[model samples]
Target chain A: MNNEKVWTAGLVVIGDEILSGRTADKNIAQIASWLQVQGIRLAEVRVVADDMDAIAGAVNALRTAYDYLFTTGGIGPTHDDITVDAIAAALGVDVVIHPQARAMLEDYYKDKPGGLNDARLRMARVPDGADLIPNAMSGAPGIRHGNIFLMAGVPAITAQMLHGLTGQLEGGAPLMVETVGCWTAESEVAEILREVEKAHEGCQIGSYPFFREGRTGANFVIRSTSRDVLESAVDTLCEALAETGRDFTPGGI
Target chain B: MNNEKVWTAGLVVIGDEILSGRTADKNIAQIASWLQVQGIRLAEVRVVADDMDAIAGAVNALRTAYDYLFTTGGIGPTHDDITVDAIAAALGVDVVIHPQARAMLEDYYKDKPGGLNDARLRMARVPDGADLIPNAMSGAPGIRHGNIFLMAGVPAITAQMLHGLTGQLEGGAPLMVETVGCWTAESEVAEILREVEKAHEGCQIGSYPFFREGRTGANFVIRSTSRDVLESAVDTLCEALAETGRDFTPGGI
Candidate 1:
């Protein structure tokens, strides 16, 4: 087993649209995938309402628990956009307009119909002593106050912020995963799955059962920091499934 | 504004697939929408890993904070499926087999191959003093202990569990929402939204920006428990947008 220190991150998805089911959230998956590429595990995620206290509570709880904390949503140019204020409160810092963010927004919106007005300038506000994360899709940038990153609620804008943060944070070895899919009920082979996982050191197997095409099947996902350990676990699981006279797919269903 | 005590729920999504970005979670929206229909607000959500400590910690935190707590995932037959154990630990109870659940599972697997093995029997286990929430999609029922409900990770199964739970929970009045979509950027209408919300006694407006068809657009979701307040807020918002000379869609984009 690798003895390297593992880095973890927590995500706070700030939006009433998500909690109210008015909008489906895509940022959690997007950010989780991006963090995986950065070799940091997404340890936890909280979907909070647009309320100031809710956002601030999640920010405070997660920021101290993980190595880094990223928040998406409620950062737009409207009254509902209170993430900047909430995060600032959580960190006990005053909100301030970043000079660079204001400059960028001014240049971008200058040619538009309505120039950078008071409402539009709200995008430039950030927690005190924060750096700006460049937004490729929109001129208003993302905010970074210490280990906490405040991103836009829109998935496209959050993607740009994540891109700007690539290769910037320190992390351990990226987790490796291999999945084996079977056309049988996982409960029928639950013992086999348990034995294989027990035999493989440093590897954890997760069985996800599904009902599709009028049949029961499951995908066994094996994850590990060591590629060799992950591969071995998959091989053992596949061989065990084969011994039970069941067909298995290597890349999953 | 109504002085009725509002009912709130906290959802704990327990799975490694969600945290790994291997599976996009549909339960948060599903449960959120369902809770709304039940006149209960989904106040918070936590996507936690399959670890026992993680699940137990979230369970304890949320179960006490809200009127009710619901959890999805990690209740399968596999070793990694430790949600039952974790939840039991959180409630300070012993794990035991529910006779009704065992009978249900036995009947469920009787006609299939490998009928009712030890692993399949694992589905019958629940925390002491728990009742079963019927799973219409699958035979293994969901467990309900006090205000905490443990459901399946699969959307279909979770739907069945939620259906069984409909009209059973005590809640306040259902929140009503009216959306207004506009082709203009939401930033241009920020003040208008704030003004509309402030004018309506019980209404709250949320701005969701979207970039589509090579143009900027936004959907303003107005929510209120009172029908009069919601309709009035929407009318004022529409009139405000019209005054700005921008076209708006009442039902949203």
Candidate 2:
């Protein structure tokens, strides 16, 4: 592992609808994108059904393996919403209603009629020792353990809770990014690309192939923490490609 | 964990572009769909870069966890094509050109000019003691060893290989499916669902919510091997929903 303050996270998507192919999982892609901008790499993502044993197993493994674990789904007001119990089991704890959570629900439903029924109270059953993670969209808040953040299954609610939690996270320094517009096949530019990668330590380069308007091209993106290192590497790459009679348009720094 | 015959498979998605968000992986979704249709449960999936060690680690872990493992990506004739060598390292063996694979490629590129160069021959390199799995789209074949199916990362080629390998696999009987649709407020329909699930053994029932145009509805999809069992459960579900003043529209069985 690159010990350079890399905070890796894994996502656990708990829903039978996803495993049954009735619903496509939108959380994985959403979380992956959000984490990338914060310089927190999403290491792995697993979509398990609402099965208790499967959820517990995945939650345990992911929480132990990654710096952070985020789970979406099975936290609604229905009988299938067993995520709280499963997480408690995984952590070898018990489900207990936190007073703060109860107060939040009370305040949220105080305005609405027939609010906070027995079924709705299920949403307040947080795992022992968990702190409330605010849900900006709805009154039903998420929960967070040491590094595991448990949010609702619905996309809108999940996005809202994640947005609320983003500001509280510790992010690494700006990871420099540079891109060059495509002109040729990825394979044709591999040899010199490998040499450039070898020359630039502490940097990673990726090649992306694209097609638009009956033309195929690739963009070479280089990322690092050091701007000088990135610039020098991009210079070498452009020079080498130009020597091979291929030109590219430089993009964002 | 069920005492019945269970077929488990794992997926390996190889490509740094996916991790960098330059490319979204489609192979996992395609393979996962095919596996679900065959009564084979997809146990897990790992996405790794084209780096040799990362690919090797994922392939090795998945190979041991499930009954079969399938890998996509890193099989093309590009410089990043390291899946062959990675699989070899994972299995503690060496990769060599298989005669059958070489013949298939030779016949495929016989008419094309400058076809089957050393770069292209890189596709024929299979781990020692592996059988060639046919690639129907392009002639460059995939390889199968024990429970591992190594396939191309390209969507079209991967789908073609999966089709070719279909006849060779042994799978459980197709799981029977029944859907009770257009139920409003899934939480109110939970108790009856539990009772129906208990009555029907060896069946899995899932509730899917769909909200569109300011209307919220749900589908209760039930799966079981016995048609009679599923019908009885569906009948009870419809009867129970009627009591809640929500008449379920019974579609074709």
Best by DockQ: 1
Candidate 1's C-alpha runs over 4 A off are: none
lDDT string for model 2 (A100-140, tens) is 88888889777654466666677789889999989865678
What are the per-residue Cα lDDT tens digits for candidate 1 across B121-189? 999999999999998678989999999999999988999999999999999999999899999888898
Worst 10 residues of 2 chain B by lDDT: B182-191
**Model 2's DockQ?**
0.34
- Superposition error at A209 for model 1 (Å): 1.2
Candidate 1: Cα lDDT at B75: 79
The superposed Cα distance between candidate 1 and the true structure at residue A140, in angstroms, equals 1.1
- Per-residue lDDT for A96-123 in model 1, tens only? 9899999999999999988999999999
Please give the lDDT score for candidate 1.
0.92
Q: Candidate 2: where is the Cα deviation over 4 Å?
A: A1-3, A106-114, A174-176, A179-183, A208-219, A247-253, B1-3, B103-118, B247-253
